[model samples]
Target: MIEVKNTGKPDERRDFPRGHLDVLDLTGLNFGVATFDPGWRWSESLRELAGTDSCQTHHNGYVLQGHLRIRMDDGEEADVGPGDVFVVPPGHDAWVVGDEQVMVFDFAGGMAEYAKAKG
Candidate 1:
Protein backbone atom coordinates (compact mmCIF):
# COMPACT_ATOMS: atom_id res chain seq x y z
CA MET A 1 0.00 0.00 0.00
CA ILE A 2 0.98 3.60 -0.46
CA GLU A 3 0.17 6.66 1.57
CA VAL A 4 0.78 10.36 1.22
CA LYS A 5 0.24 13.34 3.49
CA ASN A 6 0.99 17.03 3.39
CA THR A 7 2.35 18.18 6.68
CA GLY A 8 0.76 21.55 6.08
CA LYS A 9 -2.50 19.79 6.89
CA PRO A 10 -1.60 17.38 9.59
CA ASP A 11 -3.74 14.64 11.13
CA GLU A 12 -2.93 15.97 14.57
CA ARG A 13 -1.22 19.00 16.04
CA ARG A 14 0.18 19.36 19.53
CA ASP A 15 1.24 22.68 20.92
CA PHE A 16 3.61 23.39 23.77
CA PRO A 17 4.96 26.53 25.34
CA ARG A 18 7.31 27.59 22.57
CA GLY A 19 6.79 25.02 19.87
CA HIS A 20 4.31 22.83 18.10
CA LEU A 21 4.27 19.44 16.40
CA ASP A 22 2.24 18.43 13.38
CA VAL A 23 1.81 14.72 12.81
CA LEU A 24 0.61 12.43 10.03
CA ASP A 25 -0.42 8.90 10.70
CA LEU A 26 0.16 6.43 7.90
CA THR A 27 -0.34 2.69 7.61
CA GLY A 28 2.50 1.75 9.88
CA LEU A 29 4.22 4.96 10.72
CA ASN A 30 3.72 8.25 12.47
CA PHE A 31 5.53 11.12 10.76
CA GLY A 32 5.90 14.56 12.29
CA VAL A 33 7.00 18.07 11.59
CA ALA A 34 8.09 19.99 14.66
CA THR A 35 8.63 23.71 14.79
CA PHE A 36 10.46 25.34 17.65
CA ASP A 37 10.70 29.06 18.10
CA PRO A 38 13.88 30.58 19.36
CA GLY A 39 14.28 30.05 23.12
CA TRP A 40 12.29 26.86 22.98
CA ARG A 41 13.82 24.30 25.27
CA TRP A 42 12.60 20.84 26.04
CA SER A 43 13.49 21.01 29.71
CA GLU A 44 11.83 24.36 30.16
CA SER A 45 8.83 24.03 27.89
CA LEU A 46 7.92 20.39 27.89
CA ARG A 47 9.20 18.78 31.05
CA GLU A 48 6.14 19.57 33.11
CA LEU A 49 3.75 18.40 30.45
CA ALA A 50 5.75 15.25 29.80
CA GLY A 51 6.34 14.51 33.48
CA THR A 52 9.97 13.75 32.85
CA ASP A 53 13.26 15.45 33.56
CA SER A 54 14.48 14.81 30.04
CA CYS A 55 12.82 13.88 26.77
CA GLN A 56 12.25 10.14 26.62
CA THR A 57 11.08 10.00 23.01
CA HIS A 58 13.55 8.74 20.47
CA HIS A 59 13.73 10.73 17.26
CA ASN A 60 14.93 9.98 13.76
CA GLY A 61 14.79 13.33 12.05
CA TYR A 62 16.00 15.61 9.34
CA VAL A 63 16.59 19.27 9.99
CA LEU A 64 14.71 21.42 7.54
CA GLN A 65 15.57 24.93 8.66
CA GLY A 66 17.35 26.94 11.35
CA HIS A 67 19.44 25.40 14.13
CA LEU A 68 18.94 23.10 17.07
CA ARG A 69 21.21 22.00 19.88
CA ILE A 70 20.70 18.69 21.59
CA ARG A 71 22.37 17.49 24.75
CA MET A 72 22.13 14.02 26.13
CA ASP A 73 21.74 12.99 29.73
CA ASP A 74 25.34 11.92 29.72
CA GLY A 75 26.42 15.38 28.47
CA GLU A 76 27.18 14.56 24.83
CA GLU A 77 25.88 17.27 22.55
CA ALA A 78 25.55 18.33 18.94
CA ASP A 79 24.07 21.03 16.78
CA VAL A 80 21.94 20.23 13.76
CA GLY A 81 21.03 22.54 10.97
CA PRO A 82 19.39 22.43 7.56
CA GLY A 83 20.03 19.23 5.56
CA ASP A 84 21.34 17.36 8.55
CA VAL A 85 19.95 13.91 9.31
CA PHE A 86 20.00 13.01 12.96
CA VAL A 87 18.94 10.26 15.32
CA VAL A 88 18.37 11.32 18.88
CA PRO A 89 17.88 8.64 21.44
CA PRO A 90 15.76 8.88 24.58
CA GLY A 91 17.07 10.81 27.54
CA HIS A 92 18.01 14.05 25.91
CA ASP A 93 17.14 17.74 25.88
CA ALA A 94 16.93 20.06 22.93
CA TRP A 95 16.58 23.77 22.31
CA VAL A 96 16.40 26.15 19.42
CA VAL A 97 19.79 27.80 18.99
CA GLY A 98 19.12 30.91 16.98
CA ASP A 99 16.63 33.65 16.35
CA GLU A 100 15.14 31.71 13.48
CA GLN A 101 12.50 29.11 14.12
CA VAL A 102 13.71 25.53 13.76
CA MET A 103 11.79 23.05 11.65
CA VAL A 104 12.43 19.34 11.67
CA PHE A 105 10.81 16.34 10.05
CA ASP A 106 10.64 13.26 12.21
CA PHE A 107 10.27 9.71 10.94
CA ALA A 108 10.68 8.01 14.25
CA GLY A 109 7.57 6.62 15.94
CA GLY A 110 7.77 8.21 19.32
CA MET A 111 6.88 11.73 18.31
CA ALA A 112 3.22 10.82 18.59
CA GLU A 113 3.71 10.69 22.33
CA TYR A 114 5.84 13.75 22.70
CA ALA A 115 4.55 16.52 24.95
CA LYS A 116 1.36 14.73 25.83
CA ALA A 117 0.12 15.40 29.33
CA LYS A 118 1.05 12.59 31.64
CA GLY A 119 -1.78 10.51 32.99
Candidate 2:
Protein backbone atom coordinates (compact mmCIF):
# COMPACT_ATOMS: atom_id res chain seq x y z
CA MET A 1 0.00 0.00 0.00
CA ILE A 2 1.04 3.66 -0.45
CA GLU A 3 0.03 6.94 1.09
CA VAL A 4 0.91 10.61 1.15
CA LYS A 5 0.29 13.12 3.88
CA ASN A 6 1.17 16.73 4.38
CA THR A 7 2.43 17.12 7.93
CA GLY A 8 0.60 20.43 8.04
CA LYS A 9 -2.54 18.32 7.83
CA PRO A 10 -1.50 15.79 10.41
CA ASP A 11 -3.52 12.90 11.65
CA GLU A 12 -2.75 13.84 15.24
CA ARG A 13 -1.54 16.92 17.02
CA ARG A 14 -0.21 17.44 20.54
CA ASP A 15 0.54 20.71 22.24
CA PHE A 16 2.74 21.40 25.21
CA PRO A 17 4.04 24.47 26.98
CA ARG A 18 6.61 25.47 24.37
CA GLY A 19 6.22 22.97 21.67
CA HIS A 20 3.88 20.93 19.51
CA LEU A 21 3.98 17.76 17.44
CA ASP A 22 2.08 16.92 14.28
CA VAL A 23 1.94 13.29 13.30
CA LEU A 24 1.01 11.44 10.13
CA ASP A 25 0.14 7.77 10.10
CA LEU A 26 0.94 5.72 7.06
CA THR A 27 1.07 2.08 6.20
CA GLY A 28 3.58 0.47 8.56
CA LEU A 29 5.09 3.82 9.53
CA ASN A 30 4.51 7.01 11.41
CA PHE A 31 5.94 10.40 10.52
CA GLY A 32 6.03 13.50 12.66
CA VAL A 33 6.84 17.16 12.55
CA ALA A 34 7.87 18.62 15.87
CA THR A 35 8.31 22.29 16.58
CA PHE A 36 9.96 23.54 19.75
CA ASP A 37 9.91 27.16 20.63
CA PRO A 38 12.98 28.63 22.24
CA GLY A 39 13.35 27.65 25.89
CA TRP A 40 11.59 24.41 25.31
CA ARG A 41 13.18 21.51 27.13
CA TRP A 42 12.09 17.94 27.07
CA SER A 43 12.68 17.44 30.77
CA GLU A 44 10.88 20.58 31.77
CA SER A 45 8.06 20.53 29.26
CA LEU A 46 7.35 16.89 28.68
CA ARG A 47 8.53 14.87 31.65
CA GLU A 48 5.34 15.17 33.63
CA LEU A 49 3.18 14.16 30.73
CA ALA A 50 5.43 11.33 29.74
CA GLY A 51 5.89 10.12 33.29
CA THR A 52 9.62 9.80 32.77
CA ASP A 53 12.72 11.65 33.88
CA SER A 54 13.81 11.91 30.29
CA CYS A 55 12.41 11.21 26.84
CA GLN A 56 12.03 7.54 26.00
CA THR A 57 11.13 7.91 22.35
CA HIS A 58 13.54 6.80 19.65
CA HIS A 59 13.76 9.43 16.92
CA ASN A 60 15.16 9.26 13.42
CA GLY A 61 14.84 12.81 12.26
CA TYR A 62 16.08 15.66 10.15
CA VAL A 63 16.59 19.12 11.47
CA LEU A 64 14.61 21.50 9.34
CA GLN A 65 14.98 24.81 11.10
CA GLY A 66 17.04 26.35 13.89
CA HIS A 67 19.02 24.20 16.31
CA LEU A 68 18.47 21.53 18.93
CA ARG A 69 20.63 19.99 21.59
CA ILE A 70 20.30 16.43 22.77
CA ARG A 71 21.89 14.94 25.86
CA MET A 72 21.78 11.25 26.47
CA ASP A 73 21.27 9.59 29.83
CA ASP A 74 24.95 8.63 29.72
CA GLY A 75 25.83 12.32 29.42
CA GLU A 76 26.81 12.21 25.79
CA GLU A 77 25.50 15.19 23.89
CA ALA A 78 25.29 16.76 20.46
CA ASP A 79 23.83 19.75 18.72
CA VAL A 80 21.89 19.41 15.52
CA GLY A 81 21.06 22.22 13.14
CA PRO A 82 19.30 22.79 9.90
CA GLY A 83 20.21 20.25 7.19
CA ASP A 84 21.35 17.70 9.73
CA VAL A 85 20.03 14.18 10.01
CA PHE A 86 20.12 12.56 13.42
CA VAL A 87 19.07 9.46 15.26
CA VAL A 88 18.27 9.80 18.91
CA PRO A 89 17.76 6.71 20.97
CA PRO A 90 15.50 6.35 23.96
CA GLY A 91 16.60 7.90 27.23
CA HIS A 92 17.59 11.45 26.41
CA ASP A 93 16.66 15.05 26.89
CA ALA A 94 16.47 17.76 24.28
CA TRP A 95 16.02 21.48 24.17
CA VAL A 96 15.93 24.26 21.65
CA VAL A 97 19.32 25.88 21.31
CA GLY A 98 18.58 29.37 20.09
CA ASP A 99 15.97 32.07 19.88
CA GLU A 100 14.64 30.57 16.71
CA GLN A 101 12.03 27.87 16.85
CA VAL A 102 13.35 24.42 16.09
CA MET A 103 11.59 22.19 13.64
CA VAL A 104 12.33 18.55 12.96
CA PHE A 105 10.88 15.95 10.66
CA ASP A 106 10.79 12.58 12.39
CA PHE A 107 10.60 9.45 10.30
CA ALA A 108 10.92 6.86 13.03
CA GLY A 109 7.85 5.28 14.48
CA GLY A 110 6.38 5.57 18.00
CA MET A 111 5.85 9.33 17.94
CA ALA A 112 2.17 8.76 18.69
CA GLU A 113 3.32 7.88 22.18
CA TYR A 114 5.63 10.82 22.66
CA ALA A 115 4.63 13.29 25.34
CA LYS A 116 1.28 11.66 25.87
CA ALA A 117 0.13 11.34 29.45
CA LYS A 118 0.94 7.89 30.65
CA GLY A 119 -1.90 5.73 31.85
Candidate 3:
Protein backbone atom coordinates (compact mmCIF):
# COMPACT_ATOMS: atom_id res chain seq x y z
CA MET A 1 0.00 0.00 0.00
CA ILE A 2 1.06 3.58 -0.56
CA GLU A 3 0.13 6.73 1.31
CA VAL A 4 0.72 10.11 -0.21
CA LYS A 5 0.22 13.34 1.64
CA ASN A 6 1.56 16.86 1.93
CA THR A 7 2.22 19.31 4.70
CA GLY A 8 0.25 21.86 2.74
CA LYS A 9 -2.89 20.20 4.02
CA PRO A 10 -2.53 18.47 7.38
CA ASP A 11 -5.04 16.25 9.08
CA GLU A 12 -5.15 18.62 11.99
CA ARG A 13 -3.65 21.91 13.07
CA ARG A 14 -3.03 22.73 16.72
CA ASP A 15 -2.24 26.25 17.82
CA PHE A 16 -0.43 27.33 20.93
CA PRO A 17 1.14 30.52 22.14
CA ARG A 18 3.84 31.69 19.76
CA GLY A 19 3.55 28.62 17.59
CA HIS A 20 1.43 25.92 16.03
CA LEU A 21 1.56 22.34 14.83
CA ASP A 22 0.33 20.71 11.64
CA VAL A 23 -0.34 17.01 12.12
CA LEU A 24 -0.85 14.35 9.51
CA ASP A 25 -2.08 10.94 10.59
CA LEU A 26 -1.44 7.93 8.40
CA THR A 27 -2.25 4.26 8.72
CA GLY A 28 0.96 3.41 10.50
CA LEU A 29 2.53 6.76 11.23
CA ASN A 30 1.63 10.07 12.73
CA PHE A 31 3.62 12.96 11.31
CA GLY A 32 3.80 16.58 12.32
CA VAL A 33 5.32 19.86 11.31
CA ALA A 34 5.92 21.97 14.37
CA THR A 35 6.51 25.68 13.99
CA PHE A 36 7.79 27.49 17.01
CA ASP A 37 8.14 31.23 16.81
CA PRO A 38 10.82 33.31 18.42
CA GLY A 39 10.71 33.30 22.21
CA TRP A 40 8.54 30.23 22.24
CA ARG A 41 9.10 27.96 25.21
CA TRP A 42 7.42 24.67 25.84
CA SER A 43 6.98 25.27 29.55
CA GLU A 44 5.50 28.68 29.15
CA SER A 45 3.40 27.84 26.15
CA LEU A 46 1.95 24.45 26.89
CA ARG A 47 2.66 23.35 30.44
CA GLU A 48 -0.64 24.47 31.74
CA LEU A 49 -2.49 22.84 28.96
CA ALA A 50 -0.53 19.64 29.32
CA GLY A 51 -0.79 19.54 33.09
CA THR A 52 2.79 18.47 33.40
CA ASP A 53 5.81 20.09 34.96
CA SER A 54 7.90 19.28 31.93
CA CYS A 55 7.24 18.02 28.44
CA GLN A 56 6.03 14.47 28.59
CA THR A 57 5.93 13.80 24.87
CA HIS A 58 8.82 12.06 23.25
CA HIS A 59 10.21 13.73 20.13
CA ASN A 60 11.93 12.29 17.11
CA GLY A 61 12.43 14.95 14.51
CA TYR A 62 14.67 16.85 12.16
CA VAL A 63 15.31 20.52 12.16
CA LEU A 64 14.51 22.19 8.90
CA GLN A 65 14.92 25.86 9.87
CA GLY A 66 16.35 27.92 12.71
CA HIS A 67 17.61 26.54 16.00
CA LEU A 68 16.16 24.95 19.09
CA ARG A 69 17.42 24.04 22.55
CA ILE A 70 16.31 21.12 24.64
CA ARG A 71 17.01 20.59 28.31
CA MET A 72 16.19 17.32 29.89
CA ASP A 73 14.76 16.90 33.36
CA ASP A 74 18.12 15.64 34.56
CA GLY A 75 19.80 18.84 33.26
CA GLU A 76 21.21 17.35 30.08
CA GLU A 77 20.80 19.75 27.22
CA ALA A 78 21.59 20.23 23.58
CA ASP A 79 20.99 22.61 20.76
CA VAL A 80 19.82 21.59 17.31
CA GLY A 81 20.15 23.58 14.12
CA PRO A 82 19.23 23.10 10.52
CA GLY A 83 20.06 19.69 9.10
CA ASP A 84 20.11 18.10 12.51
CA VAL A 85 18.15 15.05 13.49
CA PHE A 86 17.26 14.57 17.14
CA VAL A 87 15.48 12.21 19.46
CA VAL A 88 14.34 13.66 22.72
CA PRO A 89 12.68 11.53 25.34
CA PRO A 90 9.85 12.60 27.52
CA GLY A 91 10.53 14.94 30.46
CA HIS A 92 12.28 17.85 28.83
CA ASP A 93 11.82 21.51 28.10
CA ALA A 94 12.43 23.13 24.77
CA TRP A 95 12.57 26.58 23.33
CA VAL A 96 13.49 28.43 20.19
CA VAL A 97 17.10 29.49 20.34
CA GLY A 98 17.02 32.82 18.56
CA ASP A 99 14.77 35.38 17.00
CA GLU A 100 14.01 33.07 14.14
CA GLN A 101 11.05 30.79 13.83
CA VAL A 102 11.95 27.14 14.32
CA MET A 103 10.54 24.62 11.90
CA VAL A 104 10.77 20.89 12.51
CA PHE A 105 9.35 17.72 11.02
CA ASP A 106 8.39 15.30 13.77
CA PHE A 107 8.11 11.61 12.96
CA ALA A 108 7.59 10.24 16.48
CA GLY A 109 4.11 11.55 17.02
CA GLY A 110 5.29 13.84 19.79
CA MET A 111 2.88 16.48 18.67
CA ALA A 112 0.02 14.00 18.59
CA GLU A 113 -1.32 15.40 21.83
CA TYR A 114 1.15 18.14 22.54
CA ALA A 115 -0.09 21.62 23.34
CA LYS A 116 -3.60 20.30 23.65
CA ALA A 117 -5.86 21.15 26.54
CA LYS A 118 -6.27 18.37 29.11
CA GLY A 119 -9.70 17.74 30.46
Residue lDDT tens for model 2, 1-119: 56888877999899999999998889888888999999999999999998889898999999999999999999999999999999999999999997999999998897878866677
Query: How many clashes in each candidate?
Result: 0, 0, 0
Relative to the true structure, candidate 3 reaches a TM of 0.96
User: TM-score of each candidate?
Assistant: 0.96, 0.96, 0.96
Please give me the total number of clashing residue pairs in predicted model 3.
Answer: 0
Tens-digit lDDT track for model 3 on 63-94?
Answer: 99999999999999999999999999999999
Error of 1 at 10 (Å): 0.4
Please list the C-alpha lDDT of all candidates, in the order they appear: 0.92, 0.91, 0.92
Candidate 1 TM-score over all chains jointly: 0.96
Prediction 2 global C-alpha lDDT = 0.91
Give the deviation of candidate 3 from the true structure as CA RMSD.
0.8
lDDT-superior candidate, 1 or 2: 1
